[model samples]
Target: MSAELYDFQDKIAKIPEQEKKAFVLYDVLGYKYKEIAKIMDIKVNSVGVYIHRARTIFFEENDDSSCRSRRPMMSMVWRLVA
Candidate 1:
């Protein structure tokens, strides 16, 4: 894996457990929202919300000074996972 993937994994470990699970299921594992929601026992919409929060938390936890105040764009977020 690349350094960015390492950083992403580290950052993911630091977020809330629910958000981490939600993000991983939907984004990394390619699970459907309904599937994730069923597994998590949350409403389907909450899956999307958790994913959004996860991405935000991922960028916020980074060491980069400029990104501290900025939420990462979805494109950049996917790049880390990709």
Candidate 2:
């Protein structure tokens, strides 16, 4: 993996357990929202909400105006690992 990917993974490893699991199931494992909800024992809507919140937190933590141009690529990786 690239350094950016490593950094993103490290950052995601620091988030809450539920958020990490929800994110990984949905993104990395390519599970549908309904499937993730069933697997996680949560409402389907809650799955979407958790992912949104997790994505927000990840972006906020990595925000840096000096690296604005890299945000898009980082955001893509964040989706995979968050």
Candidate 3:
């Protein structure tokens, strides 16, 4: 499980609007790409790309933190991108 920090909400609120919405829909809401796509009325490929971009930005911003402080769940995205 990930650390539940009160500051995480503030961190998320700081993210750009579109990416923040996508990140919350997919990660926090546990929505699948297809489900997100349908709910957002976007293409599935767009959903995937949005999530990929969001993950990249999130990881880059979190790099100064320790490994445990970064998103452990992001390893799945790295594997997919790799």
lDDT of each: 0.76, 0.71, 0.63
Ranking the candidates on lDDT from highest down gives: 1, 2, 3
In the range 9-59, model 1's lDDT, one tens digit per residue, is 788787799998988787666788999999999999999888878867876
What would the per-residue lDDT of candidate 2 be over residues 1-82, giving only the tens digit for each residue? 6777787777687768888788767655668899999999999999988876666666676566453233454466666566
The segments of candidate 3 whose C-alpha lies over 4 angstroms from its true place after superposition are: 1-6, 63-82
Best by lDDT: 1
Q: Is candidate 1 or candidate 2 better by lDDT?
A: 1
C-alpha TM-score for every candidate: 0.65, 0.66, 0.58
Q: How displaced is residue 30 in candidate 1, in Å?
A: 0.3
Q: What is the lDDT of residue 64 in candidate 2?
A: 62
Report the Cα lDDT for residue 8, model 3. Answer: 53
